[model samples]
Target: MPHAEVDGVRIAYLDEGEGDPILLIHGFASNKQVNWQYPGWVDLLVKDGRRVIALDNRGHGESEKFHDPEAYGAPLMAEDARNLLDYLEIPQADVMGYSMGARIAAFLTLNHPDRVRRAIFSGLGYGMVAGVGDPEPIAVALETDRIQDIRDRTGRAFRAFADQTGSDRQALAACMRSSRQKISEDDVGRIERPVLVAVGTEDEIAGSPHKLADLIPHAEVLEIPGRDHMVAVGDKVHKQGVLAFLNNIDA
Candidate 1:
């Protein structure tokens, strides 16, 4: 485990293999290992000769945690990614992010276009612009001690996931409060890097992948058949589609 101090926060990360780098950003309540390593993403990409870099976002995993809502946002976290790249002395790398990580990646690509060669936004779609539902219930669920008391389906799921990951509920509640700033359609259209917007066919939370792809000038879509938001992270078709996208010469 390596640590990089950026924007006054210490972010834990794993940097492995050796080749062209691909930075991996995990979803909410997910650490690098849970989202990328356990899902075989690191192995798959590494075997394909890509140097993999996966980071624990500030409030999750072994990274620094903040209890104040003002301390978190996709743009701020995007800077953490950018500064980590600077710390590693890499000018730019292909970036991939899931769920909340996808939002962070979009901000990174938009704010620092020259620092990203290509990007993959998975587990998120039109939700990036239209919004991903209200965060209040999820944040409240995380703050509640008894899981059985959480009535909102999405909130309960997130609460369970936070507990399973041994996350700081208070910090995560704060993160849930502020990390989900939606990107404007105009801003999304400004991303010049080659981009892939991937989501599961059955995913109810991601809105529509096609709708999002339509907003970006250089974006493509991948629909992981028979998978939903949770299971789609490690789908074989999703992996294959990503590999094909990365290896495409004209992309």
Candidate 2:
């Protein structure tokens, strides 16, 4: 139940284990539990002598909810992450984000490379640039209202969202709808630290994991065949890939 006050809101974070630090970021409409809990990522990283920080982004989990469209952008999300580290007195740490979290992690590396020692971004199923072009009008139509419509459209597939305790699903859906801001390819190119992008072979939303790796200079890509997004986070093969990446960084 630890919380960090950032941007006039309280952000929730789990600080566990000890040693070199690694922060885990979750995806859209997903809380830290939904995204990282099932994966055993916290235990996996801690077992490897790394402290894990699993954070609940604003509008998700126990964190504050901001319905303002501007509050949901990558810049705001990324800033919230750094702010938490600041509060915790953490100088620098490795960061790993999945799906939407990956997007913010990528931005964090680009914007504050000094704060992140290394990065592992998964569900790179699709590059941000590619996903930006996807149809958003459907989501935009329900930004301020149309709650049921948003749910009706994405509810089944993103059931974890529907299961949100209170304002989570609404706030998360608003965040997605507000992603009308243009993606900066340059920000992606500015990743100076070692990077790892991964995806399960079955991910459809983030399409072409290999292409994502190709775009990020010197980054490595690993595709876990036969595993979908959730499985990639929870499956043995995917966890091994993560450990391998972390080992390379420490090496």
Candidate 3:
């Protein structure tokens, strides 16, 4: 529940434990709890003696939710992470981002490579269409207010997360307008830190985010066999993949 004012926006983050610093960046429409805590990742990380800093980005969780597209720009988002690090007085640390978070992480690594000691990107995809996924089913879901429908279908647990960030039409529109960045394969290749790119095998975002890993010089790719983007974060297989990567860096 700690807040850090960075770049004129208030970011809510969990600053816990003591050891090598690791920043956890959640995805679009996801707060720290849903992405990390719900999946027991935050505990798993801190239990391993890592100093975990899990943040709620703008328009998500307890962070400021701005309607303006420009406020949520990718460059600005990356700067938010950098500013948080500055506020903590830490010069460098590991960064792990998922879904939309991964996109922002890529920019942070590209723009401020020196500040990142290592990086993790999951559910990565070059582009995203707000409602174009799954074709017919997605189209019907959109008609019935998919966000609410998802909550109703899945129960309050997941829907609450969607509502906490962007379960509404307006929020989704704002996310699509503001979240996309112009990172390319060339940009991916530029990160100097030890990198890990992972994606669920059945991810809805991109079929193969591991391709992104192949392009990055220091990246190791991980693909969880049967999980989708959403389930991947909670999957034991995904956890092991991340653990292995972090273990290598820790060594």
Q: Give per-model TM-scores.
A: 0.98, 0.88, 0.85
Off by over 4 Å in 2: 132-155, 164-167, 179-182
Cand. 3 TM to true fold: 0.85
Please give the lDDT score at residue 81 for candidate 1. Answer: 96
Task: Please write out the lDDT profile of model 3 over residues 76-137, one tens digit for every residue.
Answer: 88889999999999899889998778877878888999998899887774342122132223
lDDT of 2: 0.75
Please state the error at residue 146 of candidate 2 in Å: 11
Of candidate 2, the 10-residue stretch with the lowest lDDT total is: 133-142
TM accuracy, model 1: 0.98
- Clash pairs, candidate 3, are none
After superposition on all C-alphas, the RMSD of every candidate to the true structure, in Å, is 1.0, 2.9, 4.3
lDDT of 3: 0.74
Please tell me which model should have the higher TM-score, number 2 or number 3.
2
Preferred candidate (TM-score higher): 1 or 3? 1
Q: For all candidates, what are the clash counts?
A: 0, 3, 0
lDDT of 2 by residue, 139-204 (tens): 443343544455444343454344543445557667776643444566566677888888888876
Residue 241 in candidate 2 has what lDDT? 88
